[model samples]
Target chain A: MKMTKLAALAAATMLAGMPAAWAEGVKVGMITTLSGGGAGLGIDARDGFMLAVKLAGRDDLDVVIEDDQRKPEIAVQLADKMIQSEKVDVLTGIIWSNLAMAVVPAAVAQGKFYLSVNAAPSALAGKGCNPNYFSVSYQNDNLHEAAGAYLAKAGFKKPFILAPNYPAGKDSLTGMKRFYTGELAGEVYTKLGQTDYAAEIAQIRASGADSVFFFLPGGMGISFMKQYADSGVNLPVVGPAFSFDQGILGAVGQAALGVKNTSQWSKDIDNAANKAFVDGFQAEYGRLPSLYAAQGFDTANLLISAMNKADVKDADAFRAALKEADFPSVRGKFSFASNNHPIQDIYVREVVMEGDVITNKIVDTAMTDHANAYVDACKM
Target chain B: MSALLLIEQILNGLQSGVMLFLMAAGLTLVFGVMGLINLAHGSLYMVGAFAAAGAAAATGSFVVALVAALAAAAAAGALIEMLVIRRLYERDHLDQVLATFALILILSEGTRWLFGSFPLYLDVPDWLSGSVTLPGGIQYPLYRLAIIVVGLAVAAGLFGLISRTRLGIRIRAGEADREMIAALGVDISKLYTMVFALGAALAGLAGALVGAIQSVQVGMGEPVLILAFVVIVIGGIGSIKGAFIGALLVGLTETLGGVLLPQLFGLFMDPSAATTVGASLASMAIYILMAVVLIWRPSGLFGVRA
Candidate 1:
């Protein structure tokens, strides 16, 4: 009788372990600028994605994260490791455009889904748009296009444009000029990743232009705004999403006030989802959420929503679901285009001192469901 | 460009130059007096900014923050000298470089661990927050003007101390002949520590002052540090006066080149082409300046050939 009882217990234990052993865990890998000058944005993106993943509570999915250190080589290495060794099904979270260009093609070659949380270069939006590639964030041109729309409406007769001398910077100018039908007074390009802007500002003051447009992101943006304010140039300065985000407001401070820009979502957006995300983020990180964080949060949720649609079993089906635009975005009613980039309303915002913090409040809607002019160039 | 615009550009150059001087002064002093090359100098600058930001946030007084910045940087410098730097003093420049580079990694990571990878903001004093009118109808930032004043004052103080005081005499003597000073019964270690502290204090002051205008955060000092390196290289390492001049030259060249080059190119080419070529070349201007200086004066403008 004792032997019979032992056999029965062993059989039951085996029965319970069979299904557990058969379950395959899905792997997702993320690489980001987790150190150096751009670390703040990368950290925000990381946190937002993590929060979404935690909220989803997926038993079958496991996520791995790595710091690219803002180096394309390092990002590429991480991508290779994720694809070859880790066998990750999805790769995401790129903050620098150069780094994104390096990693995205690698993921595409492997037939893995790529979700970009930030760094929307126009090349990816237009000529290089891939079926496996999707930008959960705005196109590099979207915000600039919005600025252009605002400039057109403002009836600025002659405008001077400025940007860092790089591919994305050129795209910003091209994006702006597309919508803005004004006399081009002049244009100046500062060095990419430049820390000083006095000379450029001096030239701008001298140019006799009616207004100025610029697209500088991260540290470059902060430093330029400070110097521009210092130079006391009376011409109104304008740019896009990154130029006046919460990530840099503290440094720019009062200098940022009266500066207008374009963005899809601001901290002051009157939406329940955004309100909850902002409050929760501040409570967790002790700062306001930038657009980077909003997109990061949305990216994770969108991924989860697509996974649910495809039941996490079919990668092709999941990609199709993601491309179908079936998620409620924190930014009021948004969707993805056929090219896998966002199609949404972009708002013109002016930086103002709101209570203890500096934030952007929506002044007007600049563009709606705006397909980029370069869309025809994209075969997709 | 109009004459007014040129004048405005010059002022901008001056502002950039002064900021560079603030960084170079401390670095040059440390190298000259201590006979030690410190790669972690930038780390101290970062520490000072972080210290100031923390203190200012807590007390809501910029004055206290400035004081705390000095104290924190000095304490950190003295501690480093006592623990790590003292060991590397007898080592070669390569060893010193490697050790200090390691210190940068440790300090940067430690700062991030403490600050949690977010930038802290430092507010300019209400009194120094606006723009002041310049001679050419140019309004420059008041905070920047204050930086110029502080930098000049420090330069004056340093010169006075080196020429007029006993401690300065000892420091100069030690720099010339360390063994002789020790043979004469001077507490050489104490003197070295004091010099180190003094250099650290200058760096701290710079960090604290600049923090008000920029974000006070981890890795903030690296850019300034690189510029300082360029300054000392052009000025001749170990020469304070040379450092000041070299810094000014670099600052002006960078600022003015950024503005003038594009326009100059614009005169010949289309706006897009001019902007691209001009901006790229302008960014390279200072490095080119350094190379030219090195070609003419291999030992640096003020460097005494060993």
Candidate 2:
């Protein structure tokens, strides 16, 4: 143990000597949903992260990517392999909340730094927070809370809401209700992975809601939007950007037109850092970068900033450097909250068709410097 | 709470039931005729949806898309029947299940390789888009009504084919005694292939129809497959009529249970906790129905005892 501590100190000293130079090999293990329903999000995140690393021309950053298949068990297995066998100093790139919940705790407990690209579960933001864990993405509730705040400000009274029945789903509603002051017309939890939303749509229609807020991510959102469109009860649907993200807007087609969603980043954010990142991403990937990509890009740049300031082998120094958050973020106003999740401006974006290509444009700022409700719960 | 809402929810149930029938019909026929438990039937459904999406994108015609789905799923089914599934016929149910499960993984990965991981675009055609007021003054999506019409028509046609056609008689005979039918100079293998392809085409049709509204992606079929299995189990493993009735029952129960249980619980419990509890119970309603049916009949609602 003494020898190991001495070796670690020596390694830290050696790594510390290289200031802003090559930080001597910081291995990043990315276990993300690469081949399943959530693959688009993970792919964009991975590509965005790699793009940042490429743009920075960092030789020390070695990324080992693996597919989690959106299964928690698979994510746990991959995290174990990445931590124990690969000995990666940093872990990142999990899209879904359940997978993040399964992997993050154990990984952080073992003293490896985890930089989250997306999926900020509220538990991690609250009492379960770890100093070693840093989420470049907003808290799980941030976008939902932003949506609720926007709706309340817009005076959408008697709003009906729905979400899938899962941990993230529950969190989404709770977050929305936190800022939403209006009386709920109806609240329903559809089964997770439920493709059929007819019952829910009918309920929404009958409930006499002035607006609808649903947190159905992935194909569930697509189905609900399409079905809601055809149901002839267009009560102004809104949610977080998961449903309206660039990755899936095309599949949703005209159904999502004019629908507002909340996010920390958009393609039309109009900042130097954001414009450069967007242009560079389009040039590199041949597609519009989703918010997931933005999160990933921010995460990589954050790591670069931290590496420039301190050696990764020195835990306290590296943690402080990460907390500094000196990186140029595509979101423009990104900074780590007290619990390491993002404390940033959330923007409301409206889905618009630009020459037959469905995408979103920034409409309004929903919330400014939105720190989560769970920040007080976080002791660390 | 309102009668109109109840009617609309019933309609929703019927629409979902029709889609399940399309899937369960094929599953039942394949299992009944071949004595095969095919866990990979859902993969065939996925293949159908992908084929449809691809064809729709290329041709800009829903008809072409549907035809592509039918042909692709049937062809895939025939190929598997000839190559892999034929060997598993003599094997136990466990072996068949394991083999078909493997087929599901292979087909899903192969689909991802072909189409990439992103969900493909498939929407309801222009003519079928929008809502119509039912006789009871309930507004319902026209596409769902179309699905019901199409499903019932298919069921009628299928029933006619089974009862009237010589092919249907042979299928029934083979199910009764395979070796005996083979000894009686029947082309058993060819018949099996044809039946498998037909069942696959039905699943494919269902996939294409549902894919327009839901998503066209890898692993999309697995969830539907589970529901379809539940449908067949409730309806009776080999009985088409049972599958139809069972599907409708499950769909109605699912839809109504999901909508009503929360409200029912709200009468005695807090609304939020009621919703939480009700949604959980609602998901299990169909499985509970299955269990009750199994206990009552010992072989499903319409299943024949050996």
Candidate 3:
């Protein structure tokens, strides 16, 4: 009985010694795709975000992770559960734009802060933008626009553009055309989750396009690249970073090498925060950090910075602190636009084989201090 | 499109059709012989891909990988039949579906545990990595042509086995009358196990071949599995010839529809709008064909009237 009492006293003392910011215990609910086809992206994001929280070593912060299963309805249900039963102060980590569209508005409207680690849907950047919601990742169009800028600068006049037939796919093409001042030889929208690209490749070969721009993400990208390489169509390929990220690059292998992609972050970025993130991530996960991981790590640090400045319980004060964006972002200079979307530089990255491992190296800046076209449409 | 491009697209369609036939053949055979609905067939496909990928990565031999895929899928099928599937033979299709669905969850999670979340890489052999020129000067991937040849060879081999071999005779007899075959001193359970394993090996072969071209990861088999089911339904369940024909039809329709529909729509609407509509309709083309076939003949093209 005496030993039990002594142990309880010791535990109480240890708890009291923790930082005061953790006293109330900031509860963060993370809902991301943890299974299905796109599981790699979510897994990386979760690992990177958790790594940041672990490094911070804050006893007061509590995180609850849930799998969205890449389903919009399921994400909405999980968000509802997190907000009502879990009573989480913040919600973050949605990987797909469709799920984000379903979950974010309602969650933010419920007076909970939402820090998106990825998936900045155009709707959220426009009239649907909410003050309580902030995007740590690029707008859906930003990277595509960067790719377009790179292609235009390279003086490609006739390019074949392709994407999966979905909302994001349409946005990608629109983003590319926004910056591209050249004629499109062809614009094809393949079925989402299409595995075989033989028919499309045949058309591409026939179209007389000097270059190709595609936005097939995850397994779709892998299939397209392998088939493209095997088909021996030697046109220069450019795409958004979603396809060429570290998570799926190995599957793509030498086929992806020398292909240019656009992104906001790369492992080879010259910055102290990025160096720490890349090194720490590789040390922890034994793999190079992808752009998704960088976004997730930055998201956690951003929340921690806000938590340090103001208590989450004080809603207005916390909101103001978060708006200040006082954190060492992995991207080096991340700032929130008026609509709470990120305004930062997007870079062109070329996939290069370092020894045997396929990864990306930053080549050039495509866009500087870039903000989404929908920012002005946002009332807030 | 030019004539060369059209010819290439047709070849692509034929290639995809043949791959689908490889998957559909086993499924149709299993369903026709066993009267069992096995949703876990896709899991077996995934198993084959992972086994091949793991083997190729370790040994750097495509032949070893192919053999490993076949052995792994066959072994998994036999084990499942002995442990869990044998008991379900007397149960209804609903029970079989539920049990097999549980198996899918178990297999997927188990695979994730064994192979981490990231997709595994499987390289095409150097000899099969480049393109081959066709009669019309259109370049097609040699690997895809190889897949087509392999699939057709398997189809012929399956035909020979069923028509010429004693085991095939037993399998056909068992499918016709299980009790009669058992009473005739044939080992019914053993035959069932063999058939299941054979089907699994075929599925595995398809998985391994496709894995070389696409990402080999968990849940990779589901899309193919769905298409295989469609093929079997269109071809007529339990009919290998039907599966072959149905698979080819589905493949041709899917590829041609994707290309032709957009141009057809472009005559009326803007190119972007036409593409959106065309792609959407193209995805539904195979299903639409299935529905049309079913409407015309409820039992499918080759399926017998019950």
Candidate 4:
């Protein structure tokens, strides 16, 4: 009985030692991909967000994170857990479109402010856009549309379209077609997570097209590029920012060289804001920054600015302040449109090799105030 | 739709078939020799890529990186066999699978811990960096051609070693009858370790070679591992020949389906809708092929009849 009493007293003493405000710290829950094939994106978002929190040194804010494991169902469940059990005031960090779609609606329904750090699904940008939700990233269609517009300006007469079979893939094709008024030799759709591209490459080779446009990210992109190069197909490859980002550039190597894509930011961008971001990220993480990292960094700034705007003495005020456009972003000057998506410029970039580095260099600006066509379709 | 396109697609199919063979070879050998279904086999592939990246970074030599990757993967497999796998060897398949599944979790997390949850890049060697022209005016990647050559060479070497070498004979004996082999003075545990190491080395080599062509990050191997399992299942778990054929079939069907299905749909439907339907169907094609094969040959093609 004496030992039990001593143990209880010890526990009480330890609890008392912690700052009283630690208990009242603004609780923000973050969910991102943490395992399986899509883990790289999740890891970056999670680590970047935590790093931002540390850099801010705001001990007044507490963060709880969950790994969604790339499943939409798991994401929904985790969002509920963060809201009800953890009692977090805000939610952030969704890397995939499906998971974002699944979790955002739930967060908005609960009137909890959702600050999306990554995914920019067009549905969320336009009509399906929510007042309670805000994006720190560009709309999903912006980059793809930028690629289409750039290719059209390049005067590529015959273009071939290819992407994985999914909603995002469809959006990419639609986004590209919106700007490129060329004779599409063909539009080919491949399986999501596919690793081979021989048949498609062969088809493209024989089709006599001038260029091939595809939207294969991750392992799928690597496999296809390798096969395309191996088959000796001479057509230049074109893609959206994601199809050949820093995440998989190493894997694609020389195959990705000379490929053109549209993007928001690249490590090679020469602006002062970009140089600081690139140098700081490399010094801290020992590698180049992906667009995901840029987006994550932007999210941190957005959230803090909102906090200052609403003078977040309480969680409710913090939520309301974030809903009001309150942040100065590194991606030029940007504000949330009526639909809660960022109205910003999309840049068309070209992939090149600089010594050992494989990176994209922005060559042209493609679009501004780029909103998805489906925005009006979404009545919300 | 022209004959030239058809011919080109066939070649594409063949190339894909070969790539799958590389993944399936190690999986089938390990399964055949030791009735263990190592779900973590893919994790080993990932380890190989990281090892290659680390070695190349240190030495500035791609060949050294390749060698180190294979050696490290083999060592890891042997170590794992000694520490965790040997006990499970006598257990049921479900238990073996569960243990290996646990190993995958540990390995993936351990990798993240060491690598700091970031991806590392591997460069293609300068020698094989360019594209080559084929007879049909087809342009092919030199590295890909090298991969095919290397894969075939390894296949030949594996066949020769299994058929002629003393260690291979012992392995064959162990596979045929573990009890008799043990009675004949073979160190069954040592043999198992060597066989497992050999299989791991092959997987490592595949991972290292392919890493240049794909992202080398955590959990990168799981998808490939699943496809390899499917290949071995179709090929007959214990039959290397079956694995080779099974992998090729899957690769060709999947590639061709992605290309042909869209064109077929375009003949009737709008190009946009056709693309959606085609891509969805293409992804399903290989699984459907696997199902059809299983229905026709429950024991798998070339599998020894139970």
Per-residue alpha-carbon lDDT of candidate 1 for residues A324-344, written as tens digits (9 for 90 to 100): 767767787778776778888
Evaluate every candidate with DockQ and list the scores: 0.47, 0.79, 0.71, 0.38
Per-candidate total of colliding backbone pairs: 0, 0, 0, 11
Q: Put down candidate 2 lDDT per residue, A1-380, tens digits, no spaces.
A: 99999999999976665456344758899998888667888999999999999998777789999999989999999999999999999999998888899999999999999999998888888999999999899888889999999999998999999999998999999999999977999999999999999999888888888999999999899888888888899789889999999888878889889999999899998889899899999999898899889989999999999988888888899999999999999888777788888888999999998987999998899999888888899997
Q: Write the per-residue lDDT of candidate 2 for residues B1-306, one digit (tens) a residue.
A: 899999999988999998899899999998998899999999999999999999999999999999999999999999999999999899999999999999998998899889886778899999999999999899999999999999999898888878889999998887778999999999999999999999999999999999999888889999989999999998888888999999999999999999999999999999999999999999999999999988888787888634
lDDT of candidate 4? 0.78
DockQ of candidate 1 is: 0.47
lDDT of 3 by residue, B267-286 (tens): 99998899999989999999
True contacts kept of 1: 0.52
Evaluate candidate 2 and give its CAPRI docking class based on DockQ. Answer: medium
Better of 3 and 4 by DockQ: 3
In order, the interface RMSDs are 2.2, 0.9, 1.0, 2.9
Better of 3 and 4 by TM-score: 3
- Of the two candidates 1 and 3, the one with more favorable DockQ, higher being better, is 3
Mark the regions of model 4 whose C-alpha exceeds 4 Å error after superposition: A1-25, A34-36, A47-57, A225-234, A266-287, A311-320, A352-356, A378-380, B2-4
Model 3: pairs clashing at backbone N, Cα or C within 3 Å = none
